[model samples]
Target: MCGRFIDANLRGSDSELSHIKIDPFERRFNIKPTEDVLILAKQSLEPMIARWWLIPSWHKGGLKDFKLTTFNARIEDAREKPTFRAAWHHGRCLIPAGGYYEWTGERSQKQPHFISSAGNEETLWFAGLASRWQELLTCTILTRSANETVNDVHTRMPVILNAEERDAWLGGSDDLTMGAGALLRHHPVRPFGISDHGPDLIEPED
Candidate 1:
């Protein structure tokens, strides 16, 4: 599951949502769940800042009272899962990420790895779902079985969207995976604390 990732400006002026201003978007390293994130939902031209964790629209309790693991939802059964059912049909969104972090090995010796684009691409748009808990906007990334390279570290990875698939995805399309996995590349990185912030965190470790 994708638990951590990086966020930066939405690069490439020619992108589908490039017309929208993302200046308020912050550059974050080691971004975790329960934090604010940027997302572009259906029928919206402006980018929104949403919580990394999704709280279903049907939830009626206080934020602290609800407890469910919804940071990532599996595409295979999200539509059937109660937590993600509402979002699956009408809450489609696009999550902007530079890349994501994955851990391998045992708990005592977990190794961190950064997965990013293997091409000239500057941003990776993850397929996501958005929901509004009252006035609070929240989102979650979608996942599928891993591809060849990512399988070496984990069995599942975020369903990243290519430029061609972005518009269709936001339009409530189901065929989200369009060979986008092949564009990925990953490498080991130095361990870092949650408070650490900078571009160097993504740099390769010896």
Candidate 2:
């Protein structure tokens, strides 16, 4: 499951659909779970902005009752899971991100890595599903078994969508399985310099 992510830019503007832009944050070298991140979704046939974590409206008591982790949804079980089934069918969405964070290490010492497109692509949109839990809406990223490049870092990776599939994902298409399988990209991990929030942690670019 992907709990932490980084989106240095926050899109907010008058343009209805073209407002997607990154804001200047001190470069989130390390992003933790529950932190507000940016997501791109379609509303009334136009793109809109949403936060990363799906906070259902039913969770009125505050963040506790929503015991379910609304971060990652297993590709294999999402269609049948109560929390995700409806969204998979009618409430699809997209998460626009610069990169994501993964950890690999022993229980005591965990090391985090940033994963993004190889080139200087401005953003990467992830295949996602969302739902409106009462008045509050929530969302989750879909994850499949790791590909060869990501196997060493973790057993799973978020299902990333290509440019073509972005529309289908947010269009409420019924063929979710096929649509999701078509947009995945798995890149090998190279040595890249990444800094931690507290101390300076950098690695050689691979």
Model 2 agreement with the true structure over 19-53: per-residue lDDT tens digits? 54445355564555555544555644434445456
Question: Candidate 1: how large is its RMSD?
Answer: 1.9
CA lDDT of every candidate = 0.83, 0.60
TM-score to native of every candidate shown: 0.92, 0.71
Candidate 1, superposed: residue stretches over 4 Å from native: 11-18, 176-180
Provide the clash count, candidate 2. 7
* TM-score result, candidate 2: 0.71
User: Which candidate achieves the best lDDT against the true structure?
Assistant: 1
The lDDT of model 1 is 0.83
Model 1 lDDT at residue 149: 72
Query: For model 2, how big is the CA root-mean-square deviation?
Result: 5.2
